[model samples]
Target: MSQENLELLGQSIAPGESRTVDFSMAKLYTTTKVEIPIIIERALEPGPTVLLTAGIHGDEINGVEIVRQLIARKMNKPKAGTVISIPILNIFGFLNAERAFPDGRDLNRSFPGTKTGSLASRVAYHFTKEILPKADYCMDFHTGGASRFNAAQVRIVAGDKQLLELAKVFQAPFTVYSGNIRKSFRSTCEKLGVPILLYEGGKSLESHKQIVKTGVDGVCRVLDSLGMLQDQFVKPPLTESGVLIEKSRWVRAQRSGLLHVKIKCNKLVQKGEFLATITDPYGTMRFKVLAPNDGYIINVNHAPIVHQGDAIFHISTQAGSI
Candidate 1:
């Protein structure tokens, strides 16, 4: 049997070879080309193709660091199959240190984009047409939104036995059956029969050392599980047993005030436990926040000042034993 060359972005990467491809999305105001950078590593043996994408939200730096370290450490030197990694998907957002595109559109919500549509739509359309069809599996890395912190976790579609197994192998501390959003990357992948795991950790824009380490280790583990890596990498130490969560709810602030958090993300809490306190400037008013159910905190807003009805804490309930 003969091995085949991997073709992507109008380039061919032969077996045992790796190449970086710069896919131009559009030109900037200064006419500089805006390209989505990707690294393709093709092994000598035949196997499945896996894709790793990050920076869809632009400010998610943990995933960016994870992909950087993965490439730097030569983790892409697989024993079989191919690894396609895109460290930054929204280059414009990343350059501006923002989460959305310059047109104020969320790239994550612009999947299956059209060529003549908005900037985000065009970029998404290009990736959907050119990159996604080559993948057997996918992993989209993310973090909590601006001013929010998320504990390292994997979000998968519910009732997917295959994806659940892969998520467990990834070994993130928490797993949420978070379902899918309309026109999202995951949704497009799902429609194309590509099973993808959405891994979230830390906060946006800032790289957390632990979160980055966890993401890197998780990617390696997934590769090893897929029989892609020749040398099996050592598994990172698990700080907490993996939990499968059935549902989660975000607790919102009732009144606008300065937030005084009494607990941090990933902390298990009992029902009625004091979670935080909202206070006015000058200490004139205070309101206590409490947990509504027994569960662990998966996400929290870190911003000191928040408006009424702002999400404060996300708690995972109905955790099923894995």
Candidate 2:
């Protein structure tokens, strides 16, 4: 039963049968009627069900574009097992070019949602009840929010050894071992024993062609590892000494001014290295920003303007590697 053979009522797909499930809106002029477009492709052979989702945070454009390209490419050559893709989960935010919903709610933070709470909560509820339970593995795409820039990396939540192994197959430049944050989609999914890998790259409001290629390649590599795709399509590289950071800290600005940063994100920095300088009007006074420790810059604010106490940089030191 290939997906093409699936009835309008949604039937079980036979091995190698690829199909698209209409999660689209049933009505107009209402968020309640909007559908979360899903493409569920089941292979001819039985394999693990992996869910690839993007636009959890609507402002992140790289992941959204990557998912789009992936689906366009994958549809031509069907993979073995089932792959459920949600390319644009936050349609409202994506349409508005915003990070949150129209109600100013973050869908990622409202996971395993309530039916009666808020719009985001209700949407989250739909995902929890409809898609996640059917998945054996998950890959959630993300990127730096607006005003922030991040290097390509995969995040495996603490205690998820199996997810870490799958992330290893992705072979992203950086592998960050992160802990679960309360109410996060990963945290809620963890409660259900669903291991997930979080991949972050590029930045909001912009797109990187190379990063997009890497992301698509990485997703294919994971599917290959899970036996969903042909094994020889992509040969994943070995990550060279990925940093397993337990925690990261954001460096805050001391004053409001125009920020001139000297270092780049994802670069290794020595202790006391000049990171940036904040210049006031007339350039009379400048506050120098220095590295707090010897570590790598995982993320940094790209916007030149900043307020006092605003996070300007995010750094993490490898355990005992510093």
Candidate 3:
């Protein structure tokens, strides 16, 4: 059915009407069960249907926290339409704080999934079939997984002008324009004509104050844009504008040993600037890593030890306010 039909089915969603429902009637453990937790907030009027999702990669706790905060603050109240949240998708991986589910599948890669496929594929299929079709827009939150650290940034598919507008309104510290690869949540949503924003922040399984604050502020800004809530709650500074990054690259270690990174994430650097260096056990040999171009640090390797060719930093450069 078209989105217009869905909106027609329900109108003027009000207090006490907002409810949480387990879309998956059975737990993942059950042979015939699929578990998808959803929070539905129905406002008192007709408006756009927005979806906020996280934990596609079970280990990405920051996204989960973002969704939790959005829901807990009652950010969906008095909305013109519906704001749905699926805070956790990969239950098994989340339980263990691992990046992928138990079957060793990347949920994000298994979009538009099949029922008879692997665990991750099954979850992805369920999401596309059950959730994506209902929403007008989407925001999928993420963070660097276990091995790396990422600065807070919003990644919008390059060709999505409408989504880009919504993303800028989010007023995140960094907005990176990335071309979507096939099978990603962003790509799938795009194919369905559902504009989606991908928010990346901090590192996996760790908490950063700025990331959390920005996340809360980002969602509120979007809600304000969507007319879900009043404008007074929005953070004006973040809403002022954001830097736009066209392309990004990772600087890898040339030698294996201990690493000393001089620049933290979110710092601006010039081309050929010293980013980090690798030193041997006795410091007899040192490999200096330099920036290939002028850009800002979006992801930094937090691990002290590394091997040759391991990505140490991700930098992006683009003209205009970020």
TM per candidate comes to 0.97, 0.90, 0.90
Which pairs clash in the backbone of model 3? Answer: 12-44, 13-43, 47-80, 113-125, 242-321, 242-322, 243-321, 243-322
Candidate 3 per-residue C-alpha lDDT over 1-322 given as tens digits, one digit per residue, 9 for 90 to 100: 1123232113332433666666553354558665566777766567788889888887788888888877777775534777888888777788888888788888788887788998778778867886788888888889997668888889887766787788788888788888887788888998999988899998888867778778878888787877777444544455556778877888888899999888888899999999988999896988889999988888999889999988989888564684
Better of 1 and 3 by lDDT: 1
Rank order (by lDDT, best first): 1, 3, 2
Query: Residue 80 in candidate 2 has what lDDT?
Result: 59
Q: Candidate 1, residue 116: CA error in Å?
A: 1.0
* Ranked candidates, highest TM-score first: 1, 2, 3
Query: Residue-pair clashes per candidate, as listed?
Result: 0, 10, 8
lDDT on C-alpha atoms for all candidate structures: 0.89, 0.78, 0.78
Task: Single out the weakest 10-residue window by summed lDDT for candidate 1.
Answer: 232-241
Question: Highest TM-score, which number?
Answer: 1
Return the TM-score for candidate 1, rounded to 2 decimals: 0.97
Task: Output the TM-score of candidate 2.
Answer: 0.90
Clash pairs, model 2 backbone? 1-14, 2-17, 3-18, 15-43, 15-44, 16-43, 16-44, 25-35, 43-80, 80-228
Deviating ranges (above 4 Å) for candidate 1 = 237-240
Pairs clashing within candidate 1: none
